[model samples]
Target chain A: MPLRLACQAMGTRFELVLAGQSEDQLRAVGELALEEIQIAHGRWNAFANDSVLSHLARCAGGPPVTLDPETFDLLQTCVRVAKQSRGFFNPLLGPLLHKLGLRDETKLDPAEDLGTLLDVRGLVLDPKGHSAQLTRPGMQLDLGAIAKGAALDLAARVLVDEGVTCALLHGGTSTALALDPPPGKDAWQVVIGPEKHAPRAHLAHSALSVSAANSRRGSLPRGDHSHILDPHRSRGTRHLQAAAVVAPSAATADAWSTALVAGCLPSDPPQGLGLLTQTTSDSWLLAPGRPSCFHIEPCTTTTPPLTAAPF
Target chain B: MHDNHSSPDRRTVLMAGAGGAATQILPDFLAARPHLGADLRVGLVGVGRQGRAILAELGKFDEVTLVAYCDTDERRLGSAARRAKGAKGYATQDAMLAAHPNLDALLIATPTHLHRAPCEGGLAAAKHIYCESPLAHSIEDCRAITAAAASAGKVFQTGYQGRANPVYKLARSFVRSGAIRDVLSMSAQSNQKNSWRTPASDPVRDKALNWRLDPEVTLGLAGELGAQQFDVLHWFTSKYPVRVEASGGILAWHDGREVADTVQARLTYKDGSQLSWNATLGNTYNGTQEILMGTMGTVRLAWSHGWLFKESDAPTQGWEVYANRQQFHNDEGITLIADATKLASQGKLKKGVGLPHPGLYYGLETFFQSITQEKDVVCSAEEGLRATAIAIKVQTALTTGQAQDISEADLASK
Candidate 1:
C-alpha cells in the first residue's frame, strides 16, 4: 500500500504519496520531506516579517547579505528566469504587487509607474561570496511564483535521497514532481486542468507546473485584474488565460509557465521544456520542445491542439 | 527584584519594566535595543535545525558577520554553509576556531550530550560562547562547561531564550513587582505533533542523528523540551526547585523507541510551591506556554505572546481601561503589552500585542549586545546549569518512576 501524507505550508497544502516496502520507513522519510517544505516556507515567505526574504529586504542597500546555499540557488534561478523571460518573470516585483493590492487582503490602488523597481539587474548576486545585495532599499524579492515549485523540488530531492524511488509530491496541486513511475505503470498521469476534456501530462522523473491569470485576483478597479503582474507594464497580465510547462526541475517549469502566461517569452518555448498554453479565446497551444520524460495526451473528445515549430 | 505583593502605579510599573525607558513613539516596539556596538564576526557549531534557525535570525543583524559553521555531518555543514553565504564549513569546532582566529563568537547548537566539547573548545579559544539551553544531558558535563566558561573570562550565554525576550522581560517585571501577588503554583507545557525521529539514509548516521531518542545520553521530553520552559519559571520567580516527581511512558510513537513521547513532571521549590510541566510529542493542542497562578491573578506566557488575568476582587489599575483583553471561556486575560503606555497613547495598543520576532532573535541580539557593548549576559552558564539540573532530576524521576531530590550541589558549578 502507498503511504500518503499532507502538510500545510507556504499558504497551501502540500501532499506526498510514496510506494515503498516498509511503511514505517516511508512515513519517516515522507515526514522529513514535509519538514523540508516547511523550512523552505519559513525561509522565503515574503509576507512573513521574520523570513529570510524579509531580512534581505530590510538589509537591502546595506552590505551584501549571505544566503543559505538553497536560497542562493533559488535567487540565481529567479534572475536567470527573469532574463530568459525578458523581465516577465521578475522576482523584484514585490512592491508592485503590494501596490496592486495582491500581496494580502489589504487593498491599495495599483501604481502606474512600474519599471523603476522591477529591474532584475539591481539585484547584485555574488557567486563567489555566496551573497546577494539589493542596490536600493525597498527592493523586495517575492518568490511567490517559483517558491512552491522550489519547495516541491527540495521535497522530491529528500524522497530520492532517502532511497524512496516511487513518490509523487505536489504543492497545492499546481506544482508537482514525480520521483519514478509507480509499480506496473509507465509514468504518473497528471491532469493539467479541472475540465473534463483537460489534457493529461505523463510525468516520469519530471515535473509539471501550471499558472493561470484567473486563478487569483485582487481587489483592483478592473474586475479581471490577476495576481500575475507584468513587471514592464506594472499591471496584471491578460495575454493568456493559462499556461503549463513540463521540465526536469519544478522551479524551472514553474518560472517558464508563469512567463508563458504573462506573455513575456517568445512564441516558441525553451529547448528542453514542454509548454501548453490556453489563449483567451480558449484555444490550446502546444510547444513540446524535445522528446523527454514529459508527454501530453488529450482527454477523450478533446479537440486537436495547435503545435509550435520545433526549437 | 521588587516586592510582588504591593499595588504599584500601573503606568509607572509597566513603563519601568518595559525593557527600556519610554522615550520613543512606540516604546515596546522600539524596545529592540539597536546594535550600536562594533561589528562582530561569528561562527556556528552544529549545523542542524536549530543552527539553521539561528542563521536566519543572525542574518537580520547588520553588525554580525557569520564567518563559518562546524558540523560532523558534512551534508548538514555544506547545506548550512550555503545558506550562510560566505561562511566556511569545518568538520570540527577546533578546525573552525583555528581557521578563523578573528571569529569573535561561537553559537553552539549541537546535541545536549555533545555540548561540552564545543563549549570547552570555544572557551579555550577565548571566544564568546552561546550554547543552546538545558546546557547538557548530565549534571557533570553542565558543571564542566560552567567551570570552563568561568575560567575563560569571556562572555558566555545559554540559549534559555525567555530571559531575553521583551515580552517575557515585561512579564517578569510584572511578576517581580507583585502584580500577580504571591505565587501559589506554576505550570507549563510544550506540545508538538510529530515523531521525534530524524531521517537519515545510513543506519549508523540515523542513530547518531536521532540522539534525542537515545535513552543513554538523551534526556527525553522532560529535558529536551521541558527544561527550557522550566527555566522560564525559574527566571520569573528567581527560585529553584528542591525536588522533582515525574511519570511518563511511550504513550505514542512506539516504533521501537525507548524515549517517552509524553511526560508529566511536578517540581517542588524550597517554599513548597510546585511547578507542573507536561511535554508531549504526540499532540500539538494549545501549542506551548507557561502559566503562573498567583493569589491575585494568573500570568500566561506563550513564547510570542503573554497575558495577565486579574482577580475580580483584586485592585484595579488605571491602565486596565486602555489594555486589550481577550476572552477564554469564563476567564478574561489582559494582554501584557510591553510599552502599553506609549502604544495606548497612540491608540495602537492592539498592534503591540505580540512580539515582532521569536524569542530566539532577542536571545541572539542580547548575545551580540553583550559581546560588543560589554553588557551583562542575559542567561549565563550557571543559570543554564541550574535549569539543566532540574531537568536532569525530572528525567531521572520519570525514568525510575520515583521522586528525585535536587540539591544545591547538583546545580553548583564548583
Candidate 2:
C-alpha cells in the first residue's frame, strides 16, 4: 500500500502519496517533504509579520537582506518569470493587492500611488552576495502567483533525493507533480477541473497547474472579478475561462498558467511546455508544445476527484 | 448618559505608562530594528541543521559577515557554502580557523561528542566562540572546554537560547520582581514526533549521521533534549538541582537502538523545590514549553511565546489593564511580550502575542552584540558546564533507573 501524508500550508492542503517497501521509511521521508512545505509557507507568506517577505519589506530603506540559496533561487525564478510573462507574473503586487481588497487592509496612506509599488525592477538581486533589496520604499513581494508551486517543487525534490522512485505531490489541488508512474499504470491521472468535459493530464516525471478566473473571486463589493489580476491593466481578466499547462517544472507551469489565463502571454509560452486554454464559454483550444499528456475524455466514467481547483 | 465611572483616572494611566517603561523590554534589537555597525567576520564549524539555522539568523544582521564554513560532510559543506554567498568551505575546523584567522567569532554546531575539538581550535585562534549545548557528551570534555574558555580572554557563549529570548527575558524580569511571589515548583517538556534519524546514502555515512542513537557517545533524550529547558529553569530561579531521579524506555522506533525515545526526570533543588521534566520523540502534544508555578501565579514559556497566569488573590499591577490575555480552559494567561509600551501605545497589543523571530535569532543576535558592543555574555561557558552536569546526571539516572546525586564538584570547571 502506498503511504499517504498531508499538511496544511500556503492557505491550502498539500498531500503526498509514496510507493516504497518500508512504510516507516516512506513516512519519514514524506514527513520531511511536508516539513519543507510548511517552512516555505512560513517564510514566503507575504501577509505574516514574521515572514521573510516582511523582513525584506522592513529592510526596504536599509541594507540588503542576505538570502539563503533556496530563497535566492526562488526570487530569481520569480523575476525571470515576470520578465518572460511580460509582467503578468509579478511578485511586487503586495501593496496593490491590499488596495484591491485581496489582502488585509494596512494603514497605507490613501494618497500613496499603488502603481509605484508594483515595479518588479525595484527588486534588486545581488547574485554575488546572494542578497536582495527593494530599491523603492513601500515595495513588497506578494509571491502568491508562484509560492505554492515553488513549495511543491521543493517538496518533490526532497522526495526524489531521498531515493523514492514513485510519488505524487500536490499543492492546494491546483498544482500536481509526479516522480514516476504507479505500479501497473502508465501515469498518474490528474483532472484539470470539476467538470464532465474537463481534460485529464497523465503526469509522469512532470507537473501540471491550472488557473481559472472564476476560482477565487474578489472580496470587494464591486461585483464579481477574478483575483488573478493583470499587472498591465491592474484589473482581473474576464475573457479566458481557464488555462492549464504541463511542464517539467511545477513553478514554471504555475507561473505560465496564470499568465495564459490572465492574457499576459504576448504570443506562445516558452517552448517545451504544453498549454490547454479555454478561450470562450464552450470553445477549448490546445495550443502548441507537447499536448500529448492531456486528453479531453468526454465519455469518461468514475471521476477520481483528483481534480485541480482554481488557484 | 454614558458610564464615565469605569474610565481610568489620570494617575492610573500615568502609572500604567510608567509600568510599561519600567519593564525595559522595548529596547532590544528584535523588536526595534538593529542599527548598522562595524562588520564582524564569522565562521561556522558545522553545517548541520542547527548550523544552517544559525547562519540564516546571522544573515539578518548587516554587521555580521559570514567568512567561512567547515564540515566533514561534502554534501552539507557544499550546500551551506552555496547558500552563504561569498563564503569559502573547509574540510576541517582547524583549516577554517587557520584560513580565517581574522575572524571575530566562531560558532560550533558539531555533534555533542565532537564539540571539544572545534571549541579548542576556535579558542586557540583567539576567536569569540558560541558552542551549542549540551556542551559535550562527557563531563571531562565539558570541563576541558570550559577551562579553555576561561583562560582564552574571549567571549564564550553557550547556545542555551532561553537566556537571550526577549519574551523569556521579559518573563524572567517578572519572576525576579516577585510578581509571581515565592516559587514552589517547575515543569518543562519537549515533545516531538519523529524517528530522530537522518537518511544517509550508505551504512558508513549512516553511522556518522545517526550519532544521537549511539549509546556510547550519545546523551539520551533527557540530556540532549532537556538540557536547554533545564538551563532555562536554572537561569530563572538562580538555582541548580542537587539530585535527579529519572526513568526512560524506547517506546517507539525500536530499530535496535538502545537510546530511549522517551524519558521522565524529577530534579530536587537545594530549596526542596522540584523541576519535573518530560521528553519524548513519539508525541508532539503541546510541543515544547516550560512552566513555573509560584505561590501567587504561574509563568508558562514556549520558545517564541510566553504567558503569565496570575492568582485572583495576587495583587494586580497597573499594566495588567493593558495586557493582552488569552484563555486556556478556565484560566487566563497574560501574554508576556517585549516592547509592551510601544505596542500598547500603537493599540497593537494583540499583535504582540508572540515574537517576530524564533528564539535562535535572539541567541545569535546576542552573540553578535557581545562581539561588537562588548556586551556581557548571555550564557557563559561555566553556566553551560553546570547545565551539562545536571543533564548528564539525569541521563545516568535514566540508564540505571536510579536516583543520581549531583555533587558540586561535578559542576566545577577547574
Candidate 3:
C-alpha cells in the first residue's frame, strides 16, 4: 500500500508519496523531509534577511563571509549552472527583479552600475575555506528558479536514506522527483499538460520540472510580460509557451526548463536529457535514447491547460 | 483557606447564593490569599491516553507529587501508577478521593460526560480542580461544575492549552497592540486525515475506545476541537460571540458513526465582527491554522507557527528586516513569535529530530504555579464556560438549521 502526505513548505504545496513502509514510519520520514526543506528555505531564501543569500547580498564587495557547507555547496551549484548556460541562468539578477517589482523589497547599492551588479562572474567562491565573496560592489543573489528544486532533491535523498524504495516527491506540482517504481510496475506514470490529450511519461529513477511563463497572468492583458526573465538580456522572455525537462536531478531539470523557455538555451537540449517544448503552433518532444517512453494522444478540441508554476 | 464548614453540598449552596457580583469577586479574593504550601499533592482521574500525557507533564515538577491515579480501565490505571512510581491506583474517582482526602489539586482528564462528577466531587472535597475543556457534555453540567468551583473558592483551571502557548500569546499581543488596527474578521481551520479510533484488544472495548464517534457522548468536531480555537478568538478580541450559524454533515467515513466528519461555522460578535471556522477529517491540505484580518494587516497563527501580513500603506514596525527573510503568499514571516529564541537563551531548545510539545508542558506548569503562588489561572472556569457555551451553541445551530444567540443569562443559568 502507498501512503501520501501533503504539507505546505517553501511557500508552495509539497506532496510525498511513499511505499514499502507503515503509515507511522512514513509519517515520521515525511516530517523529517519537510523539516529538511524548511532548513533549505531558511538558508537559500533571498527575501529573508537572516538567509545566507541576503547576508551575501548585503556584504557584497566587502570582506569574505564564511558560509555553512550546505549554502556553500548550493552557491557552487548555482555558479556552475550559470556558467554552463552562458550567463542565461545567472543568480545575480535579484536587483533587476527587485527594480521591476517582481519580488520582495531588496536593498541595492546606489552608486554601482546595473551591469556590474548583475555580473555573475563577480561572485568569488573558496570551496576549501567554505566561504564566498561578491567581488563587485552591488551584486545580489536570487535562487528563485532553483531553490525549490534543490529542496525537493534534498527531500528525496532523505526518503532514500530512510530506506524508502518507492517514493515520489513534488514541490508546488511543477518540480517532481520519482524514486524507484512501485513493485511490479515499470515506472511512475505522470501526466504532463492537458489531461485529456496530454502526454504521459513513465519516469523511473528520474526527475521532471515544468516552466510556464504565462501561468500566473491568466487572461489578463499583461500576460505577455513573462515572469521568466533572461538574465543575459536583463528582460522577460515571452517567446515560448511552456517547457519541461527530465534529468537525473530536479535542480538540473528546473534550471534547463527555465533556460529553455527564456530562450537563453536552444530548444534541442544536450545529450542524456529529455525535452518537451510547447509553442503557439505545435508541441514537440525529444528523447535521446528511449523516444517511445512517453505516449501523447492527439490534441482534442477542449485541451486541458498546463500545470501552473509558482515562480 | 476555603471555608470547608459552609456545607458539604456546595452545589446546593452555590445555586442559592447571589448571582450578581459575589460570584465574580469570590474567586479573585481567594486567589489573592496564598494557600501556604511548599509541596503540592495531586490526584489524577481518568488516566488513559490524554491522562498519561498530563501525568508525565506533572511529573516534571519537583514540588508536585502524584498521590493517586484513577481509571475505569485497570490496564491503564496500572500503567499510570507505574509511571507515577509511588502513586496508588484506584478503579473509581470516589475511591481515589476518599483515600487521598488532603490532595491539593485534582487534574481531571476524563471523557466529556464523566467530567462533572469528578469536578464537583473534587470541589466538595475542598480540592483545587483542573478540568479538561469542553467542560462537560451538557450546559447544565458545565454550569453546575463552574458554580461549584466558584463557591468552593478553589483554583479551577481549564485545559485550553492555546492560552499557555507563547506563540499564541505573542500573536494575540500583536493584534491587540493596535499593530493590526481595527479587527474586521477572523477565520480558522483544522484539517486532518485520520480514523480517530484507537485499536482495542477486546470487542466491547473497541466500541468504548472510539467514543468520539458516538453523537450522544461526544460534542463532535465543534466541541472537541473548536473549543480551543474559540477560546483563542475570545482571547484576541476580548469579546464572546453574540450569535452563531453553523452547518455540518458526515461527509466522509460513513462507518456507522453518528458524528459529522466535517463542520463549518460562522460566529457574529456584538461589535459586528465575524469569525468563521471550519474543520474536516477528510483532508489535510493546510493542516490547522487561524487567520485574523484587520484594517491595517492580517495575522495568521497556528499552534507551532505564526506570520503577520501587513498592508502596503501600513507603518512598518521595524521588524521587517527579520520578517522579510521568509515569504508565503506574499506575506513576510514573523520569526519573533514562532522561533525558539527564548528556549535557546535558556539552553532548552535542542538541535535534533523532534520538537517539544510546549503547549501542554507550559499549561501544566501554569496550573501548578497558580496552586503555589495563589494566583489566578490563565484559563479560568469562566473562560472555559464561555467558550464551551459558544461551541455548544454552534452545534445546536448546526442541528437546528437556525442561528443561535449566546446570552450571559444562558451562561449563568443552572
DockQ of 1: 0.29
What TM-score would every model get versus the actual structure?
0.85, 0.89, 0.53
Error of 2 at B404 (Å): 2.1
lDDT minimum window of 10 residues, candidate 3 chain B: B1-10
lDDT of 1 by residue, B1-414 (tens): 112334335765334334434343556334322453798899999888899788877766768888999899988976775577767999998888888999999999999999999999899999999999879999889989999999999999999998888888788888888888999999999998778788776888988899998998999888889989988898888888998999988887879899999999889989999998998988878889999998899999998789999988788866676568999999999888776766655545664666666678889988888888877889899989988888899999989998988887877887
Each prediction's RMSD over C-alphas, in Å, is: 5.2, 5.8, 15.6
On TM-score, the leading prediction is: 2
Candidate 2 vs candidate 3, TM-score winner: 2
For A3-96, candidate 1 gives per-residue lDDT tens digits of 8888888888888988964877888888889889988998888877556787677666777877667888999999998888888888897877
| lDDT (C-alpha) at residue B237 in model 3 | 78
Model 3 pairs whose backbones collide: A48-B325
* Residue pairs clashing, model 2: none
- Give the share of true interchain contacts found in each model: 0.33, 0.33, 0.00
Each candidate's iRMS in angstroms?
3.5, 2.5, 16.4
**CA-lDDT, candidates in order:** 0.80, 0.80, 0.71
- State each model's TM-score restricted to chain B: 0.94, 0.93, 0.84
Q: Quality of candidate 1's docking, in CAPRI categories?
A: acceptable
